[model samples]
Target: MVKTKIAVLVSGGGTNLQALLDAQREGVLTDGEIVLVISSNDSAYALTRAAQAGVPAVVCSRKALGSQAAFEAAISQALSDHGVELLVLAGFMSILSADFTSRWPRRILNVHPSLIPAFCGKGFYGLKVHQAALDYGVKVTGATVHFVNEVPDGGEILLQKAVEIQPGDTPETLQRRVMEQAEWKLLPQATQMISEEIRREKDQ
Candidate 1:
């Protein structure tokens, strides 16, 4: 069987990226291969992790490119150069250009911190999500992995796993638990689902 080449886009610690690598090594995400990693921030730890894993890691900045479209053009060129068949947004912070999103469509995937359509939309990310979840006093909060659309965090539902909020849980605790869940299951499962979908489409 042919391996599905994947590119991971990240901006932070890249715990999710590490999880994908682990899954690949353990034979869980068997349908795909991580061909490259891209980080919007040059100093992003994800880049270091990707290098350690022996994958090509590129740091491209929109600030340097002058416009979002130009930045995306650079990214598009890199993805094509690396032969990336799929793109996964682990913790990528930037709002991608509409042209970029359209070019990828269902080929791009994202893992959001919340269940989405609830705690996700504009201006929601990272600790902000956790804080909002706690502030809303919702009994349950979790994660959502979805397809990428023209709008940020506005994508077709793919998978969601809810994590309960305990009575005494703070934002920090909630965030920690959520991150743990993502590392252990969500990210790998999301990637596997995308890989399987691609495999099925090809098989047909």
Candidate 2:
């Protein structure tokens, strides 16, 4: 089996990145290979996770660039240089430029903390989604792994795993639960789907 080359983009503690690495090392995620780990924030713990795993990690900052386009261009070039076939947005916080999204099209994937199309839009991220869920008394909330389009959080859905919103669950509790679910299943499942899609394309 040809392993798909993937680069994970991160901007914070790499819990998800570590999950992916663990899954791969354990043969739970064998269809693809993590080629490089890239971070927008130099201080991001995700970079440390990559380093400890012995994976090549690079820090590319948007602040250094004069514009978002320039930043995207640099990152795009880096991806090309690394021969990355898939872009996994592990915990990246920046909104990607349209030009960059056009360049990669459906090659990029992102995992959102909510069920999507519901608790997702501009300014929805991190603990915000969970807080909103609790405030609104929603009975359910979950994680979504989807393809990223030019617009923010407006991508075609690939997979969604729902978690029940128990009463008295704080934002932290809910977020932890959702993350645990995603950690065990989301990344590996999405990678497998991408691998299967690539195989089908090759056959055709």
Candidate 2 lDDT at 146 equals: 90
**Weakest ten-residue segment in model 1 by summed lDDT:** 179-188
- lDDT (0 to 1) per candidate: 0.87, 0.86
Best by TM-score: 1
Please tell me which predicted candidate would have the highest lDDT against the true structure: 1
- Estimate candidate 2's RMSD in Å: 1.4
Candidate 2 weakest ten by summed lDDT: 195-204
Q: What tens-digit string does per-residue lDDT give for candidate 1 at 149-197?
A: 8877899988888999888888889988987875358778888888878
Q: Write the residue-wise lDDT of candidate 2 on 1-204 in tens digits.
A: 777888999999988898889989998777778889989999999998998988888888889776787788778888888888888898799999777787777789999998888889889999998999898888988999999988888989999999998888999999899999764479678976886676567667
Steric clash pairs (candidate 1)? none
Clashes of 2: 0
Q: What clash count goes with each model?
A: 0, 0
